[model samples]
Target chain A: MSGDIVIEAKGLTKTYGQAVAVDHISFTVGRGEIFGLLGPNGAGKTTTILMLLGLTDISGGQVSVLGFNPAREPLSVKRRVGYLPDTVGFYDQLTAADNLRYTARLIGFRLAEREKRIGEALDRVGLSEFAEHRVGTFSRGMRQRLGLAEILMKGAQIAILDEPTSGLDPHATAELLTIIRRFKTEGVSVLLSSHLLERVQSVCDRVALFSAGRIALMGSVSDLGREVLGSGYVVDIEAEGSGLGERLALVPGVNRVEQTGIGKLRLHADRDVRPEAAAEVVAQHGRLKFLGVQEPSLEAIYTHYFAARPDGTLKEGARHAA
Target chain B: MRREGSAFNGLGVVMLKELADHLTSIRFIILEIIVMLIAVGTVYVATQQIKDTVAQDPFLFLKFFTTSRAPLPSFIFWLSLLVPVMAIGLAFDSVNGEYNRRTLSRILSQPIYRDALLFGKFLAGLMTLAIALLVLWLLVIGLGLLFIGIPPGGEEVARAFVFLLVTLIYAGVWLALGLLFSIVFRSAATAALATLGLWLFFYVIWPVLAGEISQIIVPPDPRYMALGLQTPGTVVLEQFLARLSPSTLFGEIVVAILDPTTRALGPIYLSQLQGAVLGAPLPLGASVLIAWPQIVGLIATSIILFVIGYVVFQRQEVRA
Candidate 1:
């Protein structure tokens, strides 16, 4: 992806009376990048999305989407940006084609062009067969897909999706993520918010971890794992041997070793100790079952950051990333 | 911050969608059927009564709307009462229903401004009411021509046209009221109930309360009090207070336009009737002049209520 900023928010803040929904936070989304906003419920993710769409007024700071101020030029901004809200409601009484037609008209598409675009959008979202069916009869997954079709029909340059997979099963979630990736392939800048760390990690190029209306950590997933977990590699060894932890701890470059199971031992080392450790295991005459390095999962990094404080704030040493 | 150019960019699309929905919905169809049946039945009974009592009357065609049979009210009375019912039915759930279904934010996210949605809904509701009223008017006139065996005079037709226009304006008042309540109340059921309650109060209970309040404010003269003879001041005050309700204003206009012999809507001095022939019909323009304030009153109330709905809707946050 080219390094061109499509969305920029500087010191963005939102306040409802005395309650600060979003504190001063700044971020930029580059074109053709999938940026995730990771936060738990009430962590100001949806509030931030609304502020970016100009659906809600910003209490302070500024937001620019595609070089237009959302608050001042919302029509101009809305014309180029598509938003799929958390609920993703449609006119249930109308057929899918009729619902899309209403939006097409709102976007000022000409009569001859509207039909062609609607057909293409339906086909893109795999909803062409259900075009004539009433939306009331549609399942949740079908509705979500139709919402994506609406965004495609608008020919939007940016899409802001708020919890696009909140209520979906694993199958539907995977399907939606695939479609979202397709959007990236089409060069559309996407900003998706979710509390599902694994899903976000699987799809996002970069993420900003939100904690109590503040970004506690922001970086690529691998970088964040390294930053939080430190420069250490976890090696898991399953061998039918006695005194494995004692023998593994004496190896060079090994920081700590612990027996995790009846015949399993995990060793933490500053570097790859697999080669020497294998030799030591063979000399000790232990039968090795399995030996591999375990990369830190996003779950581990998320737990590390959240477990550091009751309020989900990062500790002083990790605050530099914020 | 007003945007340049038209604030009505997407108005036609929104309006067309709403109109199509209203026309095809069962609610509107049921209302139209009920009203049409009652109107045709009332006119049929009135035609029979007119044939028996005034077969040779010069202005017999006017009786189709103004004549009251033994057990049935006149056509105008049914219209004044049921037209508001239809208007309220169409609009009571308009704004809140969108919120309940969670479509408000989705629709607002489009390129249009908030002004288009509310304005478009109002216009759509008004247009539906207009179409229904026009059809009913034609049906009544057709029935009159068939049963009465004579076409109405030019003056009678003109007066009837004015009456229909005024009735539409009256319906617009209730449409605006329902839309305002829909914006104020979140639940569709609550908005519908509130609209019906207000309709009941204005149509049935307000006139009695106005009468009592007028009596307290301007009691009858002591000499005529025992005979239930109200003073002119009491009568005028009561009339003024009753006209505050749109139903009362509509009733006054109906009486003035449908029955051209109505010389005045308020207390008429005997001197004002000097040299006037009894039972003579007033000119069509004169009848309109007499009901001018009631017409203006209906139109102004509709505008004021619509403005309230517009302001509330524009200020509302899109998040459901």
Candidate 2:
């Protein structure tokens, strides 16, 4: 990812009568970066994406895709940004290629270029073999892949995917993540929204955690985990000795220590205190049974952040909007 | 808010794509078959009946569309009903089908505005109806030629062509209604049922309701009832209420266009008809002039319905 920004939103808002679907929120996606919008089902992730795509009106604030304002210059923004809506649908009666042809025509691609682009896109998504098959016969995973192929066919500078891997199996999720990674390598900035945190965590360079029309947190997963989980590293130590937690707390860079069980101690530290904590345990005449530094997982951060909030309940009407 | 590009940027592509879908759809084929069978039956009956009375009728081609040979009404009578059904069939699922398929947002996310999608689908629906109606129109003309063994005068052909155009506009009104219902109702079945129900109310129930309403509005005069003569105000009120339906307007237009001897649509005094020949065919222009208000009424209804659908669609959220 470069220092150049591809998407920027400031004080973005969407309100429907008395209900606020997406309250004032701000975020940016840099070139060639993968930005995830992670939240629960009714958390306004989809509404924000729609606003950026200019599919819905932005009630307040500004959003720019590349350099053009999505609201006022949607054609220019849309021409360069490809969007895969939630459960992205295709014409069931049309063959996969025929469906792409319709999109290609809409994109104003000429005949020869359209066919070439469609073939290349299908091949890249591993849907080349099914190009002649009607989309109705495709499985859920294949439909998602076809949606990616549409983005690929557009040769868009930025791909905005909404719940791209919602219903995919583990194997399909891995395959889709690989394809998304390809977009990053190709220097196409990607902003994908998904509720599957851990599954998409590996690919996102940064994410905005949405809750009830507002972004509660935004940053890289590890950075968020550090801020939310209150530690850069979690060192767990297991040994048969009394006051093992006290000994680990004395280790350099270790901030807090908690005795989890009869022979277990967990340490929250600034660095990997595993080696030092292990040595400290042995010096205390304790047999070191286990010592491992736990990498902060996105699920842990998300769960921890929500659990700590006093009023994190999602609004009912936001569910209908998103 | 000034948009960067033309709102109609992708209109042709969307229209052609939707047009292809409409033409190849199984539902469209089934509708065409039923309309064809009805057209053939009516024209065959009309041709059979016209054979004996073919001696003096100047507009023999027009007779094929209006002549009833027992058990079956004239081609126009069947057409007035068939046009709406075919129109409703083509459009009842147009917008909602996209919602059900979950394809509306994906299509709108393309480099085009919502204007293109809505108007394109509408134009495509009208074009689909036009294709079928044109084919049916030519078939009747061809059958009239084959059975009557006489070429229709230019005036007869022109008047029949005007009838064809008026019927197309009438179809547009129902198409717009169906499209509106499709947008207003999410379920395709509900859209179809609502549109068909409205059509039934207008075609079958509304006229009867109008008669009752008009009588109430202009109470029956005992003196006129005893003489078996209707009160003037009651008849005018009844016709006015019935004309509110597109069906009545379509029927009136077809009547004026096909039968040129009909001089006036509304009530005319005896003094007004004294100078006119009893059975002389009016010029094509005169016939069109007579049906002009009804034709304009049909077009206006379609535009109003389409505008309503367009406004609703514009404000509607693009997500399923």
Candidate 3:
């Protein structure tokens, strides 16, 4: 909302007869921002992405990509925004380069420009050595890289990736996240949907948690954690001390202090109370052994937000939707 | 709502890419071998027999396609079946193969309409069929010139060219049928089976069914049959029902185009034939005139099939 909005959905909805797949969800993706759509498998993330790309019809409401109506001016929207579908596949019989060549032709790039762009894209993804290999022989991670390379080759202003790291190993997921971060650095808006919240948390700047065809929560990780978990900061105090818990409770911004074990305490605060708590611990003649603050992860935020509602109704709803 | 840009923007690229794939595929190579045997092998044997027993025949060169030795039907007989087989073989997997490969969604997500992909595939299949047919036609012509020393007349060339063109249209009909089934069914094997099943129904089953249906419709007039003359309208109804199959329509067209003496495609009354000279070959134009309705039927059927495919593809979801 602060910067140029690349994707703006106004109550975008999709239905199959009586069942609604995406139920009037609205969100805006700012330029050069990594926006994550995090939820379980049937949370309508992929459906939302498809509606934004105009690959599927919006049964109600509307969406726009780069200021062009996706339902009406789909070609213009598709021209500037590259989409990497979930479990993306290519012609297995064709070589990697030949596959890219076919896409380049579809993008209407001339011969000379196509080859050069393909070379650069493949090299950028570190797939230059495998350009001549048949796509049937590509590993899962390599295929994802190639999908990303396609978005890069398109020179798109926005990239929509669905489940980019679903089947990848930890090392591969790390590498993929690096390339995604590079997209943000290069000023390309990234709108990615995934169920793997923990792995993708490091890359996404803002995220929407979906459940049963609706967004349950939408904001940055820490903001949602604060609103849901009552306090966003969790600081650990490891020191040789006495009466530190009672003393640390009076520190500014520190909400409360608990004695975990002998001479150890955990502090929940509205903000970073590590500095104030440390000062207070030392003021009581305690020798500080160690101190650290845990970064709020999306996984904790997602589970805590959903679990806070009594009766486990949303979880049951999510399971039925799946 | 109006979608932006031309639907035909990437039509040529998809057409060329698919064309290249078809021509280089192993399936096409097998088809090409069968075609060589059917076109060249059949024509060569027929030429040997035609040369040995030649009388004062005016349209002798046209006989290259019509003449048959024992144990082999005329080239026209095999061709009516071969053209459809080749066309179906080329197109049965055209749409569903993309779905199975998971490439259809990716291509559709590009800056092109669904029309370009479907139309390009149909065009590419037609072009590939044309190329194979052209090569087969040339080989048969070469065999004719090699075996039969005398050169064919100008009218003979015109008539043979017309047969080639009709065969292409005939190929288009089956290609469209296969294309339609490819879109209707999501699996390539299922689409192939469905198209082949329909082809078989038309090729073998319908002709017999047509006769039975026509008999039920007109009831084979016993009063007229007592005089040893066939009943009127009965034969017409049978032919009409039979020609519903594109195979029958194509066969009739080939008969009129290749055999100049084919005076009619349907039943003819003795009174209607009384004024015509016996054993006289009609001009190429007259023969075409006789086959005009069947030719138009073949063309219309192909167009209808292709339009159905286009509509279904447009409404389909891009994801597999």
Query: lDDT value for candidate 2?
Result: 0.91
- List residue ranges in candidate 3 displaced over 4 A: A241-243, A259-264, A281-289, A310-322
- Cα deviation at A246, candidate 1, in Å, is 8.8
lDDT of 2 by residue, A1-322 (tens): 6789999999999988877879999999999999999998877899999999988999999988999988889999899999898998899999999999999999899999999999999999999999999999999999999999999999999999999999999999899999999999999999999998889899999999998889999999888988999858988888988777777788889999988888888898898877788788888899888888886898999889888874674343445555
Report per-candidate DockQ: 0.59, 0.73, 0.75
Model 2: what is its DockQ?
0.73
Tens digits of per-residue lDDT for model 2, B149-256: 888889888888888888899999999999999999999999999999999999999999999999999998889899998888999999999999999998888889
TM-scores of chain B, in order:
0.97, 0.97, 0.96
Clashes in each model (backbone N, CA, C under 3 Å)? 0, 0, 0
Candidate 2 runs further than 4 Å off = A235-251, A254-268, A273-292, A314-322
Give iRMSD, candidate 3.
Answer: 1.2
* Ten-residue region with minimum lDDT total, candidate 2 chain B: B51-60
When sorted by lDDT, best at the front, the candidate numbers are 2, 1, 3
- Candidate 2 deviation (Cα RMSD): 3.2
Candidate 2, pairs of clashing residues: none
